[model samples]
Target: MTDSSNRRRLRVGGLPQVLLQWGFGGLAALVLFLMMLLTFVDVIGRYLLNAPVTGSFEIIELMVAALVFCALPLVTAREEHVTVDLFSHLLSARTEQTRAVVVGLLNAIILTAMAV
Candidate 1:
């Protein structure tokens, strides 16, 4: 690829980028690990002690939300998320740009609504 093309690529280079990736990825990993541990303890409590962890479901739910949020930064930085390119093959270059903007706006709106 040309220099311009390389420049246009994701700006995920250098030490800061590495730190950003590690920070978010580590946070997500920690959350996942904690969730697993919680499940293990909950199971032990249920069988061995005949008592389950109180509010385990609520804790898991909150952890899941945290897991998703923590993963978002890493996903956006790496652009590793899945894409719907099925429609891209059918559109022209100019139309593709417009479609991308419209879809991005729609996505932002939907995500905002969901966040609220």
Candidate 2:
């Protein structure tokens, strides 16, 4: 596909789209920063002060979950999710497009179910 077409696939319009992108992006960045800070403090406390941060593992686990959830909307908006792409060479252009549409619909249905 052309570059513009590829971009159009990820393009969202209107104010809500802008809000969703920025909100999720900001949340993910904040969570990542906090995760890094926590890890640094935990390491320093363990080695230098002989007092590791309490419940660091649980905190990290929850932060990671938050991070993923916060980032998922942006990732979906960008259509950047992981895929195998192993059959790209074998499929014709039309078949590939059809496959992509089918997969996209399936993803929408699954996500809608999860939301409900």
Candidate 3:
């Protein structure tokens, strides 16, 4: 294949992928850390200072939802979901590939249905 054709098949280079991955991953991590920190502060404030952080529960609830939903698309893109593979280990490579494709198709259909 020509160099140009090879280049066409290639995606963003290593540096870009690293940057993008870390950028999103860091955002997710920061949200989680902030959530924990706020909860801790609120607890301490209520018990020790006799003044709770106002709307702490509401903030936590919203943060939790945002964290999960925001992470969902990234996790799907990263292919990071759990799998139960009682039979998969026994399958040949081609069989495994076919199984994966089928699973992906089903997931796509389910996502589409959910969207509707």
Candidate 4:
């Protein structure tokens, strides 16, 4: 296949995929925005009004967790994880792809086990 065709094929499609991608993106963005807004309000309340936003620290901690979880799927879908491709020059394209898939599956299984 041509490069364009390969690129097109690799692009995410379908309602479910699109929805999942957007859902994750939206969730992460919302969490981050809320965190920033909360921090601003907390700081203003503390410094200007002599009253801090109650539970802001706990809320921020929860938001951080939520942000990480929300971004996980998007990161995985984009294959944005760090890698050490020491054998990039030695491995064929197919071999590299197979290796990636196998590694991803193993990681998924481990994560699922941990979640369970």
Candidate 5:
């Protein structure tokens, strides 16, 4: 092979993507860890010390919500969400892309309605 043909274009899938994915995972793990630790502390304080961690319930609820919200984009980007695949395999590639775009538009409309 000639050197010109052997030269591959530089790809942008190295440390950046790895760091982004890992950062998201780390955030999720940190939230989970904090939740568990807070719960444990709350339990210990209530049962052993006769005093609960103040606002522990609210804090955990907020943390859980934040974790889920933060994970949504990552999940969508990864295509790890459950999807109805009925007729998807039968569709041509172009048709599938069109369907996906239309579905996305519909989702946006529904979301906008709900928001309003």
Candidate 6:
């Protein structure tokens, strides 16, 4: 628990990583903004004009998926995923380390398969 360790790391992946994260992060933000706008328009049209936006549901569905994917890199880079450590007290340190390695391998395999 040194002061240096407590500080944030520059592992944001240098220039390339920074560009990538900014790009994807911006895209995710744009998609989210569009979704909000779409929802607002749809609501206004549905309630005030008596005409809902056409294909709004489908558009929102697709946008939701895109948003998730666009934000994936950031999530992976920051390791901001959910953790359910229900049995953490029962597991030894080595066991926890082993489980992490196994999960990482499985994740890599799955992601590779999906990419292909």
User: Higher TM-score: candidate 1 or 5?
Assistant: 1
> Model 2, which residues run further than 4 Å from truth?
1-12, 109-116
* Candidate 1 overall lDDT versus native: 0.81
Tens-place lDDT digits, model 2, residues 1-116: 46786456546466777777778889999999999999999999999999999999999999998997888767776777898988798999999999989988988888777657
The TM-score, computed over Cα atoms with residue i paired to residue i, of candidate 4 is 0.77
Estimated TM-score for each candidate: 0.74, 0.78, 0.67, 0.77, 0.67, 0.81
- Model 1, 27-54: lDDT tens digits are 9999999999999999999999999999
Q: Could you tell me the lDDT of residue 11 within candidate 5? A: 27
Off by over 4 Å in 1: 1-14, 110-116
Q: Could you give candidate 4's per-residue lDDT for residues 1-116 as a string of tens digits?
A: 36675346346465677678788899899999999999999999999999999999999999998998888767676667788878787999999889988989987887677567
Q: In model 1, which residue pairs have backbone atoms overlapping below 3 Å?
A: none
How does candidate 6 fare on TM-score?
0.81
Of 2 and 4, the candidate ranking higher by lDDT: 2
- How far off is residue 48 in model 3, in Å? 1.4
- C-alpha lDDT of residue 40 in model 4: 100
Off by over 4 Å in 4: 1-12, 92-95
Candidate numbers sorted by TM-score from highest down: 6, 2, 4, 1, 5, 3
What order do you get sorting by lDDT, best first? Answer: 2, 4, 6, 1, 3, 5
Worst 10 residues of 1 by lDDT: 3-12
Best by TM-score: 6
How far out, in Å, is residue 23 in model 2? 0.6
Task: State how far residue 107 of model 2 sits from its true place (Å).
Answer: 2.7
lDDT score for residue 29 of model 1: 98
Top lDDT model: 2
Which stretches of model 6 miss by more than 4 angstroms?
1-8, 112-116
**Alpha-carbon local distance difference test for all models:** 0.81, 0.85, 0.76, 0.83, 0.75, 0.81
Candidate 3 stretches with Cα past 4 Å from truth are 1-15, 106-116
Question: What is the Cα-based lDDT of residue 17 in candidate 5?
Answer: 59
